[model samples]
Target: MFSNEEMRDMVCVYSTENFNGRRAHRIYLEMYPNRRQPDFKIFKNLYDRLGETGSFHHKRDSAGRPKTLNSEQEEEILVRVAENPELSTRRISMETGVSKSTVWKTLNKEGLHPYHFTPVQNLLQTDFPARQDFAHFCRLQQNADPMFLNKVLFTDEATFTRRGVFNFRNKHAWDLENPHLVSERHFQHEFKIKVWCGLIDNYLLGPFELPPNLNGKLYLEFLQTQLPNYLDDLPL
Candidate 1:
């Protein structure tokens, strides 16, 4: 009864098998009545003794629908597809001894969906080999001024989610939103965010927010906040 194949067979054959096999076993034990699977074993005795006695009643779930096969079959189909992408579900069911309908339901339920993933393309970041040359340039600067330039420190700030200035460039309307009306007065959005930083001969600086209205006034105030912290943390 504990074995999966037997349990599946039990559930397949008996409408109430699931409750009796797993859950009712516990309840029956606690009732101070019968021991072991005697409650289940009574099915045969009662069939012989009563022989379709219209007296028997079952507490079935409402709507009286036939049981859909357990999720096990659906799960099997999912494993089959992942294990061998070449085998279509029908072919898999044929070979593995399960029904095509079961396989179909499995695919839909498990979302064995086929889709595509586009690789991101960044031209500037594409030149991974140029990393060596960049390091070489930094080394040359270090040799040029050993004491002072070697003291140069570098730091960076990274924000996980950032708002983009304009989102309309790449945005698409799922359904035509006024295919004719193009007005900036009724549109707004912020898309992706990014990391920013700066560096000099013997100093480094920020990826901090510049502010919504980044002008001389706002820039000066931001500088004021960063300058003192930078000075304190600056390596002598």
Candidate 2:
């Protein structure tokens, strides 16, 4: 570690001598006759440092692996996460002084993982009673006949549009255990295709493509015509 004054003197001398290391060394020796002489390479090194960092002093060593966080830092991170399980690693790193990678490693070492949010339809309070009644009806039917559920056709529909679906990759809650996080999705107006599928008695039904603007008339027509074709093979 060369003194700032010595490094400054060497840089000045090196520049004044047309960047000739030998001449700069001789001039530096003359300037500091009583001071101990640095190695010949020191002049060139200091010159390069000044040019690169605009400083005579050495830059902090960054070549090796980054230093590990102390116990206190790790504790602070864990405590912050405990306080807010929803806190992301990036947010934790910003709040704390730890690097993002270090924060992630710390969380992982503590058995914490990021659980993505599941997207669900936005439901109204009124929908709860109907859902419960349906569930109760299904249970009663199953009690009456164990094969009732297998005989019933379970159907689902998905809408695809020019505007794609929501991406849930980045929506996550970080915790030691699965938080069972869910996000409600509201339907938006767009030109879309509605696809329908059904299942009954372990048999997969048609992945039928329904009309974009399916009204009661069109749906009834589908059931009267297209649906019968699919049901012909199955027992009534």
Candidate 3:
């Protein structure tokens, strides 16, 4: 439901940028910083529709009943979602005087989907410096040797237990793509088994199991003993 002027501006930017939706969106934001910016999919859809029909509007279905939602109503739905992405389709329908199906249809048409939030460990303030230092060290190593990353083994461990933790499936963040949203949960003392994995030089290493309570001693022992077993076949 963009105005003629706005649509024209979008078209100008999109064409100039070689039809890159993301670049067109950035230019649109620069042109109208104060306006509510539409998602990248909106720009692409508008451009495709214009190309197919020579019009900025959607063609009505001749065989079926009239559209449940008009262009203005669809835009209203999008605006409401942008304002509050957590809003459910039922709630949006109630506020916008449309059916839940229509609201869902509008959002689906715009390529919006519900993405669940990922569970992450809560970080302490003191951890920030270490994280930054590690990132800087990695960047320096990459600059020093082009193959440094390829030779380095990236390893991570995750704990699993019977105890029920946060249920991320119950909550969702609706968007055109994964927002990489995370909900921090403080560590809780529970019976758990840790699984470790590593990757280097296109080789996948160990789904090795470790005791629930890990310490520097146990970790060093694993590196000095068990780690060698896996590295025997590696070029390292």
lDDT of candidates 1 onward, in order: 0.49, 0.76, 0.79
Query: Tens digit of lDDT per residue, candidate 2, span 1-236?
Result: 35678668877888999988888878888988886565455677667767877876433333432338754456556656754778988787776656889998988988889887777999999999999999999999999999999988888878887656566855677899998886655547546789989898989897999998888999889888988888787765
RMSD of each: 17.9, 23.8, 11.1
Greater TM-score among 1 and 2 belongs to 2
From the highest lDDT down, the ranking of the candidates is 3, 2, 1
Residue pairs clashing, model 3: none
- Candidate 1 clashing pairs, residues 3+ apart or interchain: none
For candidate 1, the 10 contiguous residues with the lowest summed lDDT are 57-66
lDDT for each residue of candidate 1 in 83-167, tens digit (9 for 90 to 100): 4566775686665466666666656765556554566756676587697798887788767867645455554544443342355
Residue 179 displacement in candidate 1 (angstroms): 46
Residues 1-236, model 3: lDDT tens digits: 46777777778888888999899989889988977677765676677778888987654343433347765567667866875788988788667777788787888988899776777989999999999999999999999998889988899988887554665656788999999997755557646789999999889988899867899999999999999898897766
Looking at model 3, which ten-residue stretch has the lowest summed lDDT?
58-67
How well does candidate 2 score on lDDT at residue 25? 77
TM-score of each: 0.22, 0.55, 0.53
